[model samples]
Target chain A: MTRLTRHDARRILDGRDRSGRLGALLDAAAASARPAELGGEDDVLTAFRAAPRHAVRPSRRFLARFVVVKAVIAVALLGGVALAASSSLTPGGEGSPGQPVAEGGRADPAPNTPTEPVETPTAPTPSPSDTSIKPFKGEDGEDPPEPGRPSGKRLKQLCRLFLDDPRGARAEKDYPGLEERAGSLERVRRFCERLLGEGGDDGDGKGEDPQDTNPSPKPSASHEDTSGPGGPHNGPQGHKGLSARSDGTYVG
Target chain B: MRPPPPETDTELSACVDAARSGDEDAFRALFRAVQPRLLRYLRVLVGADAEDVASETWLQIARDLRGFKGDFDGFRGWAATIGRHRALDHVRHQRRRPAAPVPDEDLTDLEAPSDTAAMAVDALSTDAALTLIASLPQDQAEAVLLRVVMGLDARSAGKVLGKRPGAVRTAAHRGLRRLAARLGPDADARPTDPMIPAGALTPRDAT
Candidate 1:
């Protein structure tokens, strides 16, 4: 038997083989049509009918836009949360400076009580102290001689002394200047009691100064007290008396 | 033959264009021309599952037709490519080699005529011829089937097999030589056998 050449094979594959046997073999292979070969034609046509004319693949632009939108929303949400957190934290820190002062007052009562009385005695004897206390007295005093508008400094001093030794300070000999400026011993005690109560309860003493003036409408009594203390005492006396009356009105 | 004369390239190109435009009859014509060839090619790769694989192949072809761009020859190559992919997928899924070629004993039962005159007159049965071709090594078997049985040129067959045209042609030549040797001396001796009419030996329409 002769060997099949590349030429012969090409011819046979091209269906030009006249050499008979291999051509017949290829013919038979091609001719053999099983029913199953075309059986699914209907199914294929059905699939074709259901297919979209131009199926949509997710384009690059659409995907990029979607990602950008998501990123924007995420950044906006984070920024809003950060802004809210900073705004909330700032006021909370600034608004409560009073807490630390109140805590300090409670924590060092021993030192504050002793220092306050000594400071008060030294303060009233000095002319320099009187000049310094005058501006504060003027700013705080609304009535000329009413006891409702005392300077904060003087009221706090009297409160400390009265609270320390109310009976001792009430005696005319021990603090003659203080008793005279306060109008009477009983009034000094009452004024000191109100100052301590309001200061302790309010915790923020700096914030309570304006509020203390609302109740000091007893100018007639303060005028009488100022006239009795005489000229040298009038300025300081009027200042202290007005403050005491103011504190009284506030307490009342 | 169930299919009419093998469609000329222009006819197939027209059918593809019509099918893309939703012409049902044109799509049916395209299926008729391509399915049998796809089935026979797949059979060499996937055995009994060729039918299922071919069905999958056709479904893909139908759906993706709108995106296709080529002449009829290109369409054939495209369909064959889809079939080859689906066949390999089936083989991997099943985790087995192409079902062993019809056993030697089964081939013996077909009693393929040894005489060139008898072969020319009666022809080997389609199943028997395919079994004989399948007996060749896989590369040669696929080369012969794609080139001869599927009516693809060497370049198109090479595209389907992922080989160069030269390699596919060589494989096909070797396969035919082997098939000739198997058919024995008489079949090989008569290169110009007078008994076989030229018309009778022309490539049969697959569909």
Candidate 2:
């Protein structure tokens, strides 16, 4: 069967659905359904107040939760910002500080004091000082020769170059073309051997040379490993300051 | 099927919005506007225990109003749905009980039958009308109450009744017809032209 319309129901409720006798019946039916004030408005108010807070609306508890969420997001954002800033400030941390020193064994070296004068390469017969070994095989503006294990001959050349031209060692960090094997055990051994004068070269006026010329108190701060006079002396302090600055910036 | 309630007053809508946000004063206004009819609807459906069902219904309404997603008419329909559920629960609870409701407790609030004849307005007694409505099947009685008393449209009433709009409409028509029949031929003043056609009022005829 087709249904009664809501309009019809409203008509019945309002006593307007039917007219004449039917209207009277609708009116009579609706009148009996009139809301007898169950109680006063105060009762309703009391009931409304009595309802649990969560049921009522978004209460203060929700506001408190939202505040907590906002606080967490803010702290996370600040942390991200701090990390970004500190990373930019200190590019090299502990991981990269010991980077330039390629070979671990060559960390200790004799002081950078050239026995031979650089101006005169024309030593008679070059018998006393061996000029046969050249540490830097490459000429100016050319790539150096390929590096290999330092032999006795290669160490003599490395020690001679480390003292006379320490820039060559510094340049290896910037351009590791061929002098990549610049620091090796054999090279370190040869350097020490040269300090002791393995041959009779110490007898030919080498006795006047200062025997103990190691630069810094720390063995790690090798004179040949540093570029300038200040490079060896202030290198450790500079490294410490960088690390401390990164820490302070990270926490701040 | 149900056209929305015609109470589109800006102030009442604003009050509903405020009530949804847990504004006590706005809810108070809302309660005042809809309570009377809601109570009456409950009365028709649950008889003497209507007030108790109504309180339960209000508790649910207050709890769920925050999530309610409609204007004033939607609010009314929503409330009627809750009230219907409460009434059913009360009915179910009553059915399980071995003892019938005590007559004294049932008759306590209303005036005694002797006094009602003298004091009842328009000589149309609530007790008499409720008795007539209660005689109809549960679906028909609730349909009539929700549609007529609560001012819910067919669709909304159907939603509350858990019936299709067509079904709710049919129930209401049958209910009114049954009431007219019980009241007798004399009650139907217009006999020749029936308000509800024999087949029932379809959506087409409702227009």
Candidate 3:
């Protein structure tokens, strides 16, 4: 039926619980958050011990998948070896029995040609964030021009491709606090991908507007509030503080 | 409370290392340090189901201890997260089976405090205090318990409640204000809260 302003309450309880009669209640409740003396610690410890060992044993699904992958590689290797042997045998049997091993290797190049196509199949794992584009893969698959040259759209495309390459992911794995950097880089990559009309494996990225282009929000988009307690304009910053704190909830 | 015994954070870190090596005493020290505050937070969150939820929480903590990657502060937040989840699940179960009676043995078995005169007074008032806390609105109760009781900074408490820190601060302030009101106008004059005086709450921020 009655109300107290937050300001009034803060001023009153500013120096709390000196004598200990009432302050004891909040303290006691806070302390109660700790483990009780019910000999429950032992039981808890026992239950914890019962959890699956924290050993880095790979999951069963990973193991099964690894086995399958290994099996496919083995079969491919065997097929290549068989093709190599038959090509060598035919070179000796048919055209020139006296021909050298290197030359004979290309005598009936059908098997060797087929093996090229087989090896190319390995490129199809379909990563969502793959950024490698073989623009110079005509025949020699030569590297593109060096980055020192400044130019038009080609340069920007190259930069985006380089940043988004899977090598960046491997490099990121080694750096301690690179996650934030990687996130921003990924955003840029996604932006570039959209610019080039490249469809991403990420499903939710397709948010309508095929031609309506939007810029990637920079990592520094968040405005950090330096104001400590409050001021006359304390109203707007009120909501942002709570949302910032909530970001830390899911600790690993 | 009592400035967290000065050596607490360092001692906790050391005990964690020793406990990971399977030292019983070290593990007990950790359990002693964390259990009280953890139980208090859970009590407010899930009421009588606090002990069961706490048991589940500790089990998860023990299992995950070896893989944990932060200081004592991080450990508290981590433990609190697990405890909050367990408490939520217990609350959900209670909702589905509202008529089911909570098993009473857990609360019946709590080891009483050794400091007779102070905690004896504390015991009675604290019980009354909990009753009063449970009567507060749910958000207010959680915000107050996390800030005033569990000693979490507003930001950390916000994470546990999945709220923003500003929201947590407002909620806590409102809850305390309401609690002051419920104490029948004399609560402020009744012993005010000092920063971690003698028993129970620890200022982990101190260490």
lDDT of 2: 0.46
lDDT at B103 for candidate 2?
Answer: 39
Which digits, one per residue and each the tens of the lDDT, describe model 2 over residues A100-173?
23222232111111211221111112121222111111101121234444545544455444333332431222
True contacts kept of each: 0.31, 0.13, 0.15
Using all chains and alpha carbons, the TM-scores for the candidates as numbered come to 0.48, 0.48, 0.48
The RMSD (Cα, Å) of candidate 3 is 19.2
Candidate 3 TM-score for chain A? 0.21
Q: What DockQ was computed for model 3?
A: 0.10
Taking the tens digit of each residue's C-alpha lDDT, what string does model 1 give over B5-76?
466757977897788667888888888888878877776665555677787777756655654545566667
Candidate ranking under lDDT, highest first, comes to 1, 2, 3
What is the CAPRI rating of model 2's predicted complex? Answer: incorrect
Question: For all the models shown, what interface RMSD does each have?
Answer: 44.5, 37.0, 14.9
lDDT of 2 by residue, B32-149 (tens): 6677567767765555666766766666466445544455665676677556545544543343342555232453353223334333553233444444454456667767767666
| CA-lDDT, candidates in order | 0.53, 0.46, 0.45
Per-residue lDDT for B18-46 in model 3, tens only? 66545666666777777767776676565
- For model 1, residues A3-55, the per-residue Cα lDDT tens digits are 67788778888878735577666676776444445677887788777664523
Report the lDDT tens digits of candidate 3 across residue range A103-177.
Answer: 433333423333433222112221213211110011111112223333345434443443344223222222211
In candidate 1, which residue ranges exceed 4 Å CA deviation?
A32-34, A54-252, B1-6, B96-124, B187-207
